[model samples]
Target chain A: MKLAYYPGCVSRSTGKEMDVSTRIVCAALGIALQELEDWNCCGATHVPSELVSVGLAARNLAQTDLPIMTSCSICYSNLRSAALTMEDPQVRAKVNAVLTKKYSGAQIRHALDVILEVLEKNDELITVPLKDLKVAPYYGCLLTRPRGGIDQPEFPTILEKLIKTLAAEPLDFRLKTFCCGGPIFMPQEQAAEDIAFLILKEAKKAGAEVIVTVCPLCHLMLDAKQKALEQRYGEKIGIPVLYVTQLVGIALGLNPDELGLEMNAVSPMPVVEKVYEKMAEEA
Target chain B: MAADEEFKQEVLRLAGPEVLTCIQCGTCSASCPTAHLMKPSIRRLVKHCLEGKKEEALRNETIWLCTSCQLCTVRCPRGIRPKAVVTALKELAEREKIKGKDQAYEELFQRQIKDYGRIAEILLSGEFMFVFPQGALQSMELGLEMAPKGKIKLAVEKIRGRDEVRRIMEELGKG
Candidate 1:
């Protein structure tokens, strides 16, 4: 499987580990990730004008003939929604007006789409079983939203299915599809942190050993700002947040360093060590 | 708040006529995470817009509080996109120059995105501090924590095709 990889802004900046692990895992799955040349921002929810956001996303879509894959849920949703928005002739014409090269509607898929396709075909790819690991599959807003989602929008079990593929237990997390409050982090600090706190507290209560986040911003909120969330909420909720690829990398027997597990703020190292211990004992 | 009176029609045009499809089920506000924190919840926002209550709708600060989760969009049995409706409200608010706490920050954010095509966390924070000093300071500690870990980028790389990016911004943002 080959794809045009558009590692969104956060992937390069705050979520570097996601980019790394995604590349590594794609390589392992014999999937080639062709990085989109001169890709700009996905025109995150912050973009001022709807037309500008569509045009910005249209630029990247027009750049690749091949199906584009992004690890960040924000990028995935923006790209997918842009492609959908272009279905309207008026909107398409308005969007195409700004494009140096007109957008012809490219196929946009999340990295999980390709990875899941490969994993579904060949279960042998998962070398380490991650047996008994209780993973709360965090979809965090975008991976499947706005329309034409990979799974059901309100209730998605695909992440849980992926967890089961890794021989791990998928916890019944009620807040799995809830917002990580990443977008409002700066403007609505207390609200964003309060929402993040809810997710962390729930994960801890549900006995989630680790949370596999679908979006980079989700990782930043749940993992990077975990200390701050703890400080603000006045509680010790320390469930490690890992990129979906990072968790998949773990089950593939990849090294913790290769997965950038240490870079995770909440310290996923203990979870890594536990996985390794289980693997060693199984051996 | 501007009492444009055309606010209802404008929102309908921007967000689609699905605004009229709302059954007032309250599912949207119920599903919304930050709805409780906002002055006018999602359901009420829809009601206010339909009722042509401009100030109660657009100036509510609820539109800005939206995380764009789309839970309201997906969960709406009437297929009304509360997220898109609220986003359209936000866009309309900015276009109308109706300012608020979050709206002011959004303008700064849009300016930064226009500048670099991508955000450099530290640099953006520097400009952001002036508008939102408290919010900036709150994230500063997180920045300090992540900087040593090589997570936060000190400088954001401008894309090679930034000229095209600028043209897109100039054209579409002119609206």
Candidate 2:
């Protein structure tokens, strides 16, 4: 399966490892990824003006005729939202007036969607299952939102199904689709930390050893800001955040380097080590 | 209540007429995770927008605080998207020159996109730090932590077709 991959800004920079693992997983699954020739930033969460956000996203959409696959959920949201926005005749005309080419509808798929579809097709490909690892699937806010969105916002089962397919225990946490306080992370540290704390606390209470996500922004909030979250809340909730593909890569017996496990802010080694130990014991 | 025709029409154009469907059920406030942190709360902001309190609605810090999470939008029984309304109000605020903390990041993002056609997180943060040293000092711990991992890039790599992006933006009258 060949898809036009859009690895948003985060995956290219701070979240490079996420991008790397996504590529590794896709290759292992025999999927060909053709990156957009020259994609720009999606204007992220805080676009200065509505036109700028729509224009930037439209420019990227114009680059590909194929369905767009994204590593970051925000990129998925922005691109998807932009494509949906262009459906309005007036908005389409207005946006086309500013662009050299007219933007049209493009199917936007998250990395998880691609992963799940692949897993469904080839269940026997999993040689090494992630045994005994309790995973909490964190949807953050963007992945499944803005009415008529890509997935079920209230109860997303895609990640849970993927975790179970990997033979890992998927914990049903209350905060699966909760806000990880992404936009406020930069401006309002306290508010961001508080929201992160709530997520971490709930995941820990649910006995999840690691939190897996598809959004780079959620990974940053839950993984990078964990130490700060612990300090602010004065509690040791040491759950590591891993990209969904990282967990899939591990299950497919891919090398740790290929999965970019070490690049994660909170080390996922402890969780990986436990999974390996459980596998050995079962053997 | 005097209706701010301009504000209401602009919001309706960008965000859709769903804003008028708000029944003031406070579901948005209840659904919002950061409503407590917001000054006027999202419900109040919607009310102010309806009442044509243009200056008050656009200038509020709450307008910029929205994470665009869209929880309020999904949870609202009226099918109104408060998140998009917030974005619409934010655009208005930016046009009116009502500066907020988020504007700093927005300006930095716009500049980076215009210059390179893509954002290098490392360079963007460095530029952000240079622009707001105080904020940098506060987030110094994260910088120190990520430094050892060699994650931060010291150089900027311009995208191949950056000129095309610039031309498009210029066509849009943004340049």
| lDDT tens per residue, model 1, A124-197 | 98988889999998888888897686787778888888889899999999999899999988888888988998
Residue pairs in collision within model 2: none
lDDT of 1 at B158: 81
Worst 10 residues of 1 chain B by lDDT: B118-127
DockQ for all models: 0.69, 0.55
TM-score of every prediction relative to native: 0.96, 0.94
Q: Tens digits of per-residue lDDT for model 1 on B14-52?
A: 788978988999998889989879887788888888888
Compose the digit string of candidate 2's lDDT tens values, residues A1-283.
9999998887756787889999999999988999987788887886745666777898889888888898898998888888887788876777777665668778888889888899889988897888778899888888887546657888878888889999999998899888888776766766777887899999999998899988887888888778877876789988889998898998888888889888888899887778778788889
Q: For every candidate, what is the interface RMSD in angstroms?
A: 1.5, 2.5
A-chain TM-score, model 1: 0.97
Question: What ranges in model 2 sit over 4 Å off?
Answer: B1-3, B167-175
Query: Distance (Å) between predicted and true CA of B91, model 1?
Result: 1.6
Name the lDDT value of residue A63 in candidate 1: 92
Q: In candidate 1 chain A, where is summed lDDT lowest over 10 consecutive residues?
A: A42-51
